[model samples]
Target: MQRFLPLIIVLVLVGVFLRMMTLEGRNPNEIKSVLIGKPVPEFTLPGLLEEEADLTNAYFNREEPVLVNFFASWCVPCRAEHENLMKLAQEHGVTIVGVAYKDRHADALEFLDELGNPFSRTALDRNGRLAIDFGVTGVPETFVVDADGIITYRHWGPVVGDGLEKAILPALEEAR
Candidate 1:
C-alpha cells in the first residue's frame, strides 16, 4: 500500500488538472443559479428614490413580469448593462426594479443620475442581506420573476452584448 501511495497521488493530481482545464474555456457567468424556478425571497427595503418610501417583494405582484436587478455603484459591469435595462423599461414596457447591493445611498443616487435611472422602483439593500436570500454570488445579477412572484430565470452577470437580447428578453417573454 505504501509503494502505491505515490501512484494514487499522481493520478489524483492529474484528475484535478483535467477538471480545471474544462472550466478554463467556460465563462464564469454561465454558472447556473440555484434560485431559478423557486419563489422569490421576500423582503421589505427602503426605496432608492425616496428614503421614507418602501420597496417590498409585493412590488413584484403585478400583471406583468418584473426584472429584479441586483447591482452596486462600485461595479463597472453594472454600467455596461444600463442601456439594455433602459430599453427594457422604456421601450418594452417592462418593470425593472433594482436592488442596490452593498452601496452607499449617495453613491447609488449619483450612479442613477449619471447613467440614467431605468428602474421603476429601486430597493436599497444596504447590508447585502437581501442579496444573500436571492443566492447572489456577485453584483450585477438579474432575476426574472413571473407575475406570481416566482423566479423563472437568473442571469449571473451583467446583461450585456447578446445577453440581454438572447437570455433576458426570451426568459421575460416566456414569463409574461
Candidate 2:
C-alpha cells in the first residue's frame, strides 16, 4: 500500500486537473491577473511612433478609465483583435494605450500602418519589462484601469467575439 501511495496521488492530481479543464464556461485563456483591484505598476516606455511622446503610468491617472493592451506585431491573435480595438476607440470613445511587447519599432509601425492605429498613445515594450509588471501572460492581454489608476479587470487573450460587448465594455463602465 505504501508503494502505491505515490501512484494514487499522481492519478488523483491528474484527474483534478482534467476536471478543471473540462469545467463548463471555463475559458482556458483567461488567467486571472494578480494586479486586479490594485494600482498599476509604475514604468515608462518609449513611444512606438517617432513623433509620439513617452508613455508612463501618469497617463492612466485620468478622470476616465483607460485600457492598456499588450500586443506584438508577430502575434496572430493580436491581428484578430485589432478591428475590435479600433471600434472601441473610434465608435465608443474608449481610451486605449498600446504596448508593443518585445517587438521592433519598425515592425510595430508597419503593423499599425497596415491595421489602423487605435491607441491614443503607443509604447514599445522591447524587453517585455512592462508586460511582466502588469502580470501579462502573453501578447494580446488587456487591463482596464479605473480613473484613480486601479486595475479593475484583466482580459487575457485577444478581445474578439463578444468579448468587447460582454466583458471589456462592461468592465470599462464599471471602472467609470
Which residue pairs overlap in candidate 2's backbone? none
Lowest lDDT block of 10, candidate 1: 24-33
Task: Tell me the tens digit of each residue's lDDT in model 2 across 81-103.
Answer: 99999999999999999999999
Model 1 alpha-carbon drift over 4 Å, by segment: 1-30
- The 10-residue segment with the lowest total lDDT in model 2: 25-34
RMSD of candidate 2 to the truth, in angstroms, is 2.4
Alpha-carbon TM-score of each model against the true structure: 0.84, 0.88
Query: Model 1: clashing residue pairs?
Result: none
Report, for every candidate in turn, its global Cα lDDT versus the true structure.
Answer: 0.89, 0.94
lDDT of 1 by residue, 40-132 (tens): 888889888864479877777889899999999999999999999999888988888998999999999999999998898887899999999
**Top-lDDT candidate index:** 2
